[model samples]
Target: MSSDDPPYLMALPDPVGAGKQKFQLCMSELLQLVRVHLPGRMAGAGPSEREQRIALRKALGYLDSDYLIDLPEPFFGALLRAAVYDPDPSFNRQFVEPLRVAFGARRTQEALLEVLRTGTNQERAGAARAWYWATLEMVEDIQVRWDQAALREFVVNEDIDVRRCLLPQLPLHPSHYPGELHPLVAEAVHIGRTHPDEYLRHRVELQVRTGI
Candidate 1:
């Protein structure tokens, strides 16, 4: 829907009032009571994939229009953090799959990007973690570039996540990351991307794609 469309074109609601209060409350409740322990529960898949999918779909639908949309999916981001830092390879697929199915292709790509740019820490981290898995699925599909200028600009983004996200895909070779102050940039990029919150990711990645 275009901004020019009537209902769709309305101004952003007050985040603390008409807009995101409901979402924030929902997140607080879920994080404190529900999602806080999903990873541990996720140790086994037989619990009910179908049921899980249904709940996730419902959650995403509600959060889509919320200013705090990304808060509810913190567990998914944890999975991505594991993928980025955890050494395990085979079993983590369980954590990653539910995340991809719920948030990957199903949710609007634009929604993910929107959170990456402006959402809160929970929102951004959740989205970034989801995005890492999402991007990994399509990594091979990314257009390769010999354009040094474009890649350099991207690798140096002020937003940690943007830089970090683009990093795994950029110049694809470790040798490409420079050896000097570049390591500092790499470390900063790593911390920002791996942060517990996604807003940090949004900021990091922006540094590469645009400016802080």
Candidate 2:
């Protein structure tokens, strides 16, 4: 690690997991919550289903306000999964705040850049989303270097989730990107318009219709 990098950004023991000790512990807890709350094997209604629901409730309860302050790396994946499986509005309320906190942190750019470069597909996708949030929430602190990196990496990203993160942000903040990037952003817009997911297509269409 370079001298300029935050202490939290330095490579740590793999056995300890990603980020610093607090973040690693958070991941461990979230992983266990996911494992424990996973729906039972049987498809039809049964005691297993009942037990699973109870376990899921307990897991949700575990995610209190304090726990949502500085979430784990895996928390993003868990948040997406919770939206699908749990479909609870409370999860949305709990999830977004912590993500904002993380994105607004001092060393977030370095950490997110590392994730974009080396993390798993889901982690990279989450990093892309974090970039979008930074644009909206930490605009003053964000440097042009980070914006340029997003343009270079995400415009042609293989992961659909990663692409989804930046498509709308590009049109909304064209000044952040130079004129040469418009074509690439346009292509992303076209992809978003045709994307199979209804929500993604709607977001793209909204951006286009608004001419932002």
Candidate 3:
């Protein structure tokens, strides 16, 4: 199988480790634990975006200090993997936002780019999932680099999950891609047209229609 093939397609053994298992469990219990440990930090009805961001930070501090202090790598990866793989986009910010804040946006973006370029299929998908939150207010140049990398991955990666995670974030319009890279955008459109996943087709159609 090619490098872009996902583990399942290659019949590879499960890559998840003890730390990841524990992190998944922690995520399952996250809301309840946050309520217990950081009561009233969560906003009430109709809270502003800033209020919600503050609440998320407070809860993350509690988790880092208490729950995840002992979590190891091969899963935690200093919370980068955990943050990206988080099933909930909104809750994923619990990890992504803190990394950007603590490490600086440029550094965080570089780390994510590394994951996208060389990590496992799951990691690549997670990086895509976490990309938006990490790039908030980032410079256009950095954003373009990420866009190019993601577009390349999307064209070559046959993993449905990875493609699904990447579709919404990819720049579908041809204008967004440079001259040499325009073919990648075409390949992505072709994949979207041919891929079996309904979500992928729908996202691609929507993006193409909107020219975004």
Candidate 4:
């Protein structure tokens, strides 16, 4: 976790510890616990790495059908964001896979798109990262063409995070890039070139070179 993790987390034992303690929290308490504890347990300095993993696993376990229905949209969003912002790439993927299963890809994607369109900046940023990871799984299971429809929707979105997420993940293969996306690619290039953020511009430039 970053040093920036909030102070409240300090009171909670490491998430792994909480899981092992088996406090028998009901779904509501578990959800509330995560809302309070996850940022510190998942994001900040660890009491121990093992404890952190245990905590994450415990939290993911709560996404079972009984608990899933009780989860508020914002709580679900926080779960996705936690997985997306996790520092360890391999572990991040491992942790989020259960979330994907629990949430289901199609519904998760729908929610993410909505967040990208209308949620606050933090939600949109989290949605962008979450969507990128989801696309990684999607690219392999389905034909490349499936991505095109989502790409079309994202390309027109005014949110820079949405475009940033889609542009980098656009398959660098011929099959994925039908000519229809050219205008969108060009538009992205324009936006990227002029964008205030240097990192975003740099990412978009790669698409520019590929001629999208």
What would the TM-scores of all predictions be? 0.29, 0.47, 0.68, 0.49
TM-score of 4: 0.49
Candidate number with greatest TM-score: 3
Q: Please give the ranking of all candidate structures by TM-score, highest first, separated by commas.
A: 3, 4, 2, 1
Which ten residues in a row are the worst by lDDT in model 3? 9-18
Native-referenced Cα lDDT, model 3: 0.67
* Candidate 3 lDDT for residue 179: 93
| lDDT per model vs. reference | 0.40, 0.48, 0.67, 0.49
Instruction: Give the lDDT of residue 94 in candidate 4.
Output: 41
Query: Would you list the clashing residue pairs of candidate 4?
Result: 1-43, 1-44, 15-55, 16-55
Any runs in candidate 1 off by more than 4 Å, and if so which?
A: 1-96, 103-108, 120-129, 135-156, 159-162, 171-212
lDDT of 2 by residue, 108-200 (tens): 455556666766655555555555433344544454555666666565675555555545454434555788876766666666777786656
lDDT of 4 by residue, 153-193 (tens): 45566555445544555543344566777666555557667
Screening candidate 2 with a backbone cut-off below 3 angstroms (N, C-alpha, C), the clashing residue pairs are none
Q: Pairing residues by index, what is the TM-score of model 1?
A: 0.29
What lDDT is obtained when candidate 2 is compared to the true structure?
A: 0.48
Best by lDDT: 3
Candidate 1: residue 90 lDDT (0-100):
31
**The 10-residue segment with the lowest total lDDT in model 4:** 9-18
Which scores greater on lDDT, model 1 or model 2?
A: 2
Task: Give me the runs in candidate 3 sitting further than 4 Å from their true place.
Answer: 1-22, 25-77
